[model samples]
Target: MNADELYPKRVRSQKSDARRNLSFASRRRNPNLRMCQLLHLQHLDASESKINGSSICNIRSVTSLNLCGCTNITDMRLIGICTLPQLTRLSISWCVNIKGHIIGCGMSNLTYLELRGCDGLRDVNLNDISALLHLEHLDLGNCNNITGASICNISTLTSLNLTGSGCITDKGLSGGLSTLRQLQKKKQVTGSCLHSMPSLRRLNVSRCWRVHDENLRQMSTLTKLRYLDLSGCAVTGSTLGSISTLTHLDLSRCWDVTDVGISALSTLPELQHLTLCNCQKILGATLCRLPALRVLNVSGCSQITDVMLRAICALPQLEHVDLSDCATIMT
Candidate 1:
């Protein structure tokens, strides 16, 4: 007789007992039961799981955890997660309930943290996360409460996304980013207390209305940048010469950028992705110099006719092109 049919109740109890008795070694030998426990788990994606605090407390040995969209999660649950020693990456994006001084709870080992769309987060001090020496990637996009002071102490950060974080003004950028850049460059100087994070590669400050030419000029010190998104910022052509290392540039909706600003981008030989959507000033024919361009978006550029298309087609690597809302492009 089958084990289930022979002794249904007793068999189920025995199986549970057997599972409980199974050691880490035995679990490793049985690959099928890998998900039975957290001992060997290195990554956990509980996004949108509606999981509770007790469930999260049971998880250990996981290096990466994605709790994105876990709307039910609160700061009380995060206290339990802080006990996880090996957690290196944590994504709590859109978890609105997680607000106010949550990172100070033993999250020093985290290298990547995403708090995007966490609108409830306000007036958080960056000094709280300053102890995280290995932190490289931090996304605070749409977290309007986060100011420039929130990033001053994180000198190890390489990628930072502050899209739509209106609270960050020129003072904050200068205090944090400009100071960090200076600290990184002056490593040989004596009595330099600041740690070097010269590895900064990507920065997105899009929709920061307070960002003007002065702010962009200050950002030019970040020479290692590969991807930069300054869309909707108040910058002019003069800001382009400083960031010649950029490969992916997004200037969409920047009404201030005219042919002069577009002409300045020709110096960026590494540029691959270019977005100029809603830029009403571009009259066309200046993009042919960029040979590495693969993606181009000129949507809402009313003056762009077949002349711009001809310049874009010359790019041998061009793979994606968006000309939507262009009145001159024939159907």
Candidate 2:
């Protein structure tokens, strides 16, 4: 309920030994119990409850609210929910009817927000969200009427998901880099953590068909990224090599990936979990080179034969692997 679906795919791909996240855990580790005083720990779960619009505003003192899969949710009810003074984390995923730009209505305290699968949210103003100074984690996956250029203007965000958003094209990404850096420079001297936070630590642009290497390779300002998903994108891996700090990467169904590009991945010291499923080009020749990889998925890679499977199984640090649908690999 606490914006848990913000990293939906990441949670599903995890293994028993998935690397621990110390990013937000440090605050929870503090010995002084009072130091970690959270805003509002109370939560309301009206998700799919068929709750009416008038009754929606009656809820109070709630900080985290879950309205996932709520088919009857209307714009007015959503507006009422957003007006909750203490609301900080909200998930309106799959809410079919939410429209209008009124999400910014009295919602000045939001830090985590998820609007996944809400295609009705289109033509919304960037200022309505940029006004949310504390917003850090945001998911706009599968939403309509979004432009990559507009997203780059929100300088305070740390994690962003634009999965299946056709608005993300190569031209837009190339232009957004300049817009991002310009915003970065304008807020460089700000002392507030809300304004001074660096570029995205996690990003998901899966199923964005128009994202190619011609635009992706030029964006060097995104070097701070740790988790990246380019699943079903048409990148050839030129930019993947430059993101050396990346620990988790998903390149599933990236058809253009080849030995040259995959070989470049061996140099990534911190990378652990990688998924290259359905990639027709992967032959497993260069995959075993990633000796430090812990979890690997090469499922549906038709070119991976039994010899390649042996090579993959020999990886020193590999703990888990998926060979499903790889008929060529008889072993």
State the displacement of the C-alpha of residue 248, model 1, in Å, after optimal TM-score superposition.
2.4
- Model 2 stretches with alpha carbons more than 4 Å out: 1-41, 68-83, 93-98, 117-124, 148-153, 166-198
Q: What C-alpha lDDT, on a 0 to 100 scale, does residue 238 get in candidate 1?
A: 50
lDDT of 2 at 178: 24
Each prediction's total of clashing residue pairs, residues at least 3 apart in sequence or on different chains, is 0, 0
| Candidate 1 residue-wise lDDT, 1-331, digit = tens | 1112211221113654443233333445565764436455565565665655456556576676777788888888888887888888778888888884667568778878887778877645466766787887677767877665657677776656665565654445444443232111111111111113334466555665555665565546567778777777676555675777889888898889887777778888888999999999887677776788899999999998886687778789899999999998885
lDDT of 2 by residue, 127-149 (tens): 47767777766677677566554
Q: What's the true lDDT of residue 33 in model 2?
A: 29
lDDT for residue 137 in candidate 1, whole number 0-100 = 68
